[model samples]
Target: MYSTILCRTIECLTRDPSQNRKGDPGVTIYKIELLKLQETIPDLTRFLSDSECQRANRYHFIKDKNRFIICRALLKLLLAEYTALDISQISIEVDAHKKPYLPSHPSVYFNVSHSLDYAIIAIAENPVGVDLEYINKEFNYKEILPNVYHQKEMDEIEISKDKYLTFYKLWTRKEAVVKAIGKGIDNDLYKISVIDGSHTIPSSLVCNQKNLYVFSFMVNHNYIGALALTVPINNLDDILFQPLPR
Candidate 1:
């Protein structure tokens, strides 16, 4: 399934500001390395709202705290480009499902996900969800598989030579689908399957009498990522992969 999906690697450190003036008709994905933005922490903090700052302060560890700050700050920076609004003036609100949206710009829909080293944002004209997972080989997938993955998915992972990578691929896809629906992990993870070759779309779920599509990809050698969107896969073209400036 991944082999058929188009994935591009972006190396630019900056983007044209004019590109953000309007939302793309298709999906636009922005990738950022947290370490690259560490120097701008102070500036990023200033762009965050009071509520965001409070939430960042709640992190128990300094690293965790900074990760939150960098992710949020970058989100605002990218969003500012798309909305053509001042970074500080970008009003963000969470829905009942805890998915963040631009209240002033309802047509723009987006979702964000981060792994240990990278943060990714997916923007589209419709509802979208994205997930990124850092491949951890030492972690115990054996104990957690049954609870989150369907039996068929578990069978694929168990028989694989590299169970760790397989697990993350399936996990990110399921997460992307739930996040696309704005339900987060509250939905049953086992209900979706990415390994079932029959479902050409990465994963699928029926929501409000409509079907959602998920597509998985390899973000880098170390990270596995997935994107879920309301539009059918065939209708999605022009997925731009750009790197956000620090």
Candidate 2:
């Protein structure tokens, strides 16, 4: 069922410009196919910090290690483009909650997320969080849904015929919200309500007295994604999906 939904979503995303959503002026998004970038890892390694290199080496699987290196290297490359700073000079620091940030360029905000085959980054002037998830039909949602989802959200999923799609949509939205707030999974997912129509354009979400707007979309059909931002949703339109240079 998810595969079917993915095909339809991809078709919608690839539709003619006249039929699709227009680009947003305030937000910039970049999507990279990790598998395609693997060959470039050797060359991209030069941009990674010593700590990053060590972190990458800690991953037991060679594929996982390579993905980390590529994601970090690509993130630095993208930040350099927007900040006009040298890639080697850009420094990343994490908050107490573990959200990464550019210490040297505080005004430039960004968030990154990666699934099995892709990595996505979102950049904006204000705080932002982006999430990408591969729809897996094999996972057991019944046992996990109750703990992770709000009662209302669980009810929606329970009543839906396509539980898998509904679960990912709700999961991504909640994760995006928490990420945008830099709280990670420590915050309760139930507190955030991102059900279908409720989070329409210009939606208002109050987190720790700070308001945010969220936007959700499909990534190449197979993946579900969402972006949470401190700015207005109207400032964001269709995501500008660009490929990573090899």
Candidate 3:
């Protein structure tokens, strides 16, 4: 699996930035016809699970059943060609930290993350964790930063010119690693240090942890992406990369 897959709203990329912020994030709907595409990849058909999916988490303060439909749909569409099965055949489970796994295909483990305009699904045969964060200056970093990082990390902020953004890069990377380990913020982040100085990525990023490869990407002109994967596997270059057909 990759450290993480960073994505953006194909629609959002075209909209006026101010409008996306002022109004509700536009709703996206999935067409049932795409489900029929499963004929091409029969394995994905199992992922539809219409009964429970029809009932999503209504308790959630915000509602987006359509988003879930499309997210799963997109995943099946992507995997269809590889397994040559339908999108609905794909089955997944979530771990204690909410990491998603493929039960039918135990060799494939993945993590899903999204931002206001983007949804990403990462797949790997190895157990992995993934997280994506869109830096919001309006968001409070101080309140949440301490839970994982210590005073030293906080102190680094004062001395850095882009301390706020640095916090996100570090924060996202830490969270990604935590998720990879199947642990959430409940795990201590003191063990992780993301130091990107003079092209120097820390040797300690995961020296203690064996077989995990960490990678990061910058997105939305400002947001940072962090991903961690178990190593000795395929490097990302071998994987096919493409955006979903919005």
Tens digits of per-residue lDDT for model 2, 1-246: 010000011111444333434554566777888887878889999999899899999999998999889888988998998899889888889978788989998888999999999889888888888888998999987887666877877898989898887788778877877787776675355656677643322222334424556667888658888877765655344565654544
Q: How well does candidate 1 score on lDDT at residue 53?
A: 92
Worst 10 residues of 1 by lDDT: 1-10
Model 2 worst lDDT window (10 residues): 1-10
| lDDT for model 2 | 0.73
Tens digits of per-residue lDDT for model 3, 1-246: 112222111221333323323222111111123343434333332356765355444435322554555567566665554456665676666756566666666665666666555555665556555556767778777776667676767787768798777777677767776676776665445646545421222334433344455555655565556666655333242222234442
Instruction: Give the residue spans of candidate 1 off by over 4 A.
Output: 1-25, 196-206, 233-240
RMSD per model, one decimal: 5.4, 6.4, 10.3
lDDT of 1 by residue, 33-107 (tens): 888778888988998889999999999998889899988887888888988888878878998877899998988
**Model 2 bad stretches (over 4 Å):** 1-12, 15-24, 199-207, 243-246
List lDDT for all candidates, in order: 0.73, 0.73, 0.53
- Model 3 TM: 0.65
Provide TM-scores for the models: 0.83, 0.85, 0.65
Give per-candidate clash totals: 0, 0, 20
True-vs-predicted CA distance for residue 213, candidate 2, Å: 1.5
lDDT of 1: 0.73
- Which model, 1 or 3, shows the larger lDDT? 1
